[model samples]
Target: MSTATAIDADAAPWSPAQPVLEVRGLNVDYGAGRDAVRAVNEVTFTLRRGEVLGLAGESGSGKSTLAYAITRLLRAPGVITGGEVVFHQPSASGGPARTVDLLAADARELAGIRWVDLSMVFQSAMHALNPVARIEGQLTDVLKRHRPDMAPAERRARAIELLGMVGITPDRLSSYPHELSGGMRQRVMIAMALALEPSLVIMDEPTTALDVVTQREILDELMRLRERLGFAVIFITHDLSLLLELADTIAIMYAGQLVESAAAADLLAAPRHPYSLGLLNSFPALHGERVKMTGIPGSPPSLRAMPTGCKFHPRCPHAFERCSAEQPALLTPAGSRGKRTVACWLQTGDRVPPEPLGRPEGDRSQDLAVGGH
Candidate 1:
């Protein structure tokens, strides 16, 4: 796997014009009534045009559910209880941009928007790809449906171009999914996602099973493609370290709710949430003085019988009286230096905050993530 020249996502100059997608108070439930468990609870975020927003958290954090809900891929048992998902798109008249509430779009409306304006790359490429169909067939199937007027020769050419963009050779287009390696399959998934030239791409841990070197190479290629295509991304994964390098901004999810959202640099330098700090500490640093690796204490709270007050109160090292008494709402406090939105009582600043033990405020998150790969 060969890596491409990469642009520093944080160092890039980005002018955020209008959000391409705005998800407001979106809630998803597994069942109905009392038995219902909220998989995504009032999750809110905005993805600026051509920006990469990373959603990071542990397993069962509802990142995948949020992706499915946004794409309207959630099945019957998974019902969206409330909130709005607005997608900003160019209008037919090419005047002011058009806005469509994805949550409210009917089946026909959604079908038209799905592959045309937005696309998703699922986690398991092996499972998502058709074992019977060759790569060329799968790639051209998208074009044939979306571009009915396209000639066969044109479709074949387009498929070849898509494969080349993802670092795959045109000759491999005839090979079946099983014939390709895991990394190659993942790249094919990415190519398929981009087949329709969607303005936004949602990827759900597409490189989780690949080796670190392969992961870096794939990410480099993906970033290279994004720069060329100018597509916004909503990348979902548990690796905050990867997001710190690849994403412009990151949002941390805990127990189906957003605990913190900030610019990647800001979050890495000064994380306000304890869970965020814990997650950063879980991964080992590739450079700098390496201490013993520490794991996050305990497990995520069970959604069925959610912990009262703060969901992470049970295992929070800095938990106090208020943590178990009242749930904290995501808020930006006075005198905050970063674009930090934290849901911890320690961050509210109204009350005297807990001291970070012996660690300096600026060094805490760094201690966890300094020189992290």
Candidate 2:
């Protein structure tokens, strides 16, 4: 949370191309000093206003850690060793924008910013909600806390409006979390997150446990809300195909580091990194002749025993002598057109990739992996 005012949906128009959140050289560790194990390594990315930036990777790729670190929600043994999370918030009353470093914000400052300027929807709806409290209380409690200037009747009306926006009727307000279906509960969580009209919403696998149909419905709702509210979203999930459709840009992480980042359409058409190609091939194509699902050869390296050079070199099919001996930095490819960047020797080094960086779109027969796993 930063000392930034909330953007008024009606008054202050959103600048979609402007940078809303910037994370630079962010590093997160699990413990202190000698016992520390790095979980998020020098991660850097910029999220533009009113954009959907999807973060995709394997289970242990530090996606969640990076999100928590960015929001200053890392707890206990988890520690942020370095970096800056700068938030650029527009003024509500036609004033100059306010900038603040979220990592340096005190508890009071954070309290003022959370739910007002920034909010989050966690992985599980059931786990995020209060089991004992009614939905009405849960929704209104946020307004009560953050908008102390508002009267009780106003909070109740806002709560009803929030639930309605998420497709929940006011009659269900008296029901407890357990009384609602899984989708309804998830909608409630989303409603609560949107109650204060936050500028950015971090959704960490919000639909993980639901059925595919429910997931689609929730995603559609999210897109509709994003359109209406003009809020940026950092959607963290492992489903590459889903990200292909839902995200404007996608960032792929591996072993606590970003291996590749590009526009969603570009990344889907051509992933530069070997690891990214492996992940894309692992999923069955949405519309094409059926192809066998192939997984990456090995599991992710443990945080404490990470391999030298590129962290993915051990499991990467394109790994070569240079990959094992020297680490690669994230950089634009020689003849690239846009902001696409990758951390792989094949793209960054003098040597070129084995084939054209990508296959023809919708053609799944030509996979990046040379051998079967």
Candidate 3:
């Protein structure tokens, strides 16, 4: 992995209101040369200040890989072959922003910026926490490293405050990881991520293992904290329904590339891509009239032997001749009132646009269509 130190970061100016994170032409390879298997292919996106951007896709769609790549947490063999990840953070004294390419940041720079500027809440709470350590020990570790000036008593107070923020009692600070419930453990993970009060937090399926009710509770609590603290979030999950409820914007990934991105309401109401529509149809309506769950027909393509052109064409019901012959670039459509971008030929008028599947039963006035959009 490489960070863009060659760009002379100090010489270039940065916008005061620039996006928190910007990724351009990002590519990830599992191996080198002829044996390389491209996991993420030229994926690009941006995260604005204090906004929630939800990422959704089937397994192997590169959602988690993209997150790991952005945070410089990707392991060996998962090489970042190309791309620029720019992080814009406010100056130490709240002056103008400092822009740095995460890919080019050296170990020293990365260590300085990680918890203070950006943090990650991994997928598995049980695995993320150390079984042997007490909650106070775990939380205080970050304080000791990043805030060395903090006194021991002050650090203990801060740890208790963090626990209270996540709805855990201060008394639990003495308890070990195994003593907490699954939901509590996940909340602890969120607390740890927030201890430094970073500008952006990337949560990779943080509530995947919890029960539905517990998951919803954790998400609601997270939203409350976000509103209170004003931190941007990149919430990665395969659950579209959860995103529709919480995210400000949503992006759908298919076979390593973004297929559609729009405001949460717009994408739910009128998903432009066939894959997005199929995914919407796969989930049952929680409140509306019950409908048959219709999953996408085929499985995701393998990285080693990916299909030519649009990787999703083979599974897309609306795909045409051009889809298999040539790939489509993501671009904004003509009638989109907002910043809605999609990678479908039909939307770009390369083919006659088919009528979108009608709204799902029992919720005609709602923003999404589960029957098929």
Residue 123's lDDT in candidate 3: 91
CA lDDT, candidate 1, residue 347: 77
Please give the lDDT score for candidate 2. Answer: 0.84
Please report how far candidate 1 places residue 84 from its true position, in Å: 0.4
List TM-scores for all candidates, in order.
0.91, 0.92, 0.93
Residue 233, candidate 1: Cα error in Å is 0.4
Q: Which ranges of candidate 1 are over 4 A from the true structure?
A: 1-16, 92-94, 352-368, 371-373
Candidate 1 local lDDT, 214-296, one digit each (tens): 89999999999999888899999988888989999999999999999988876776677888878877878777775787768
Compose the digit string of candidate 3's lDDT tens values, residues 3-38.
Answer: 445344453333425588899999999989999999
The digit string of per-residue lDDT tens for model 2 on 1-373 reads 3334233224334466668898999999999989899999989999988999999999989999998888889888999999889877666664555666888888887787788888999988898999999999999899989889999899989989988888888999999999999999999999999998888999999988899899889899999999999999999999887888789999999989998999887786677888877887887555646678877998999999989999989998778898888889989866678788898888854875776464333445553332221
Task: Give the residue spans of candidate 3 off by over 4 A.
Answer: 1-17, 357-366, 369-373
Residue-level error in angstroms, candidate 1, position 354? 4.3
Error of 3 at 268 (Å): 0.6
Error of 3 at 355 (Å): 2.6
Which candidate leads in TM-score?
Answer: 3
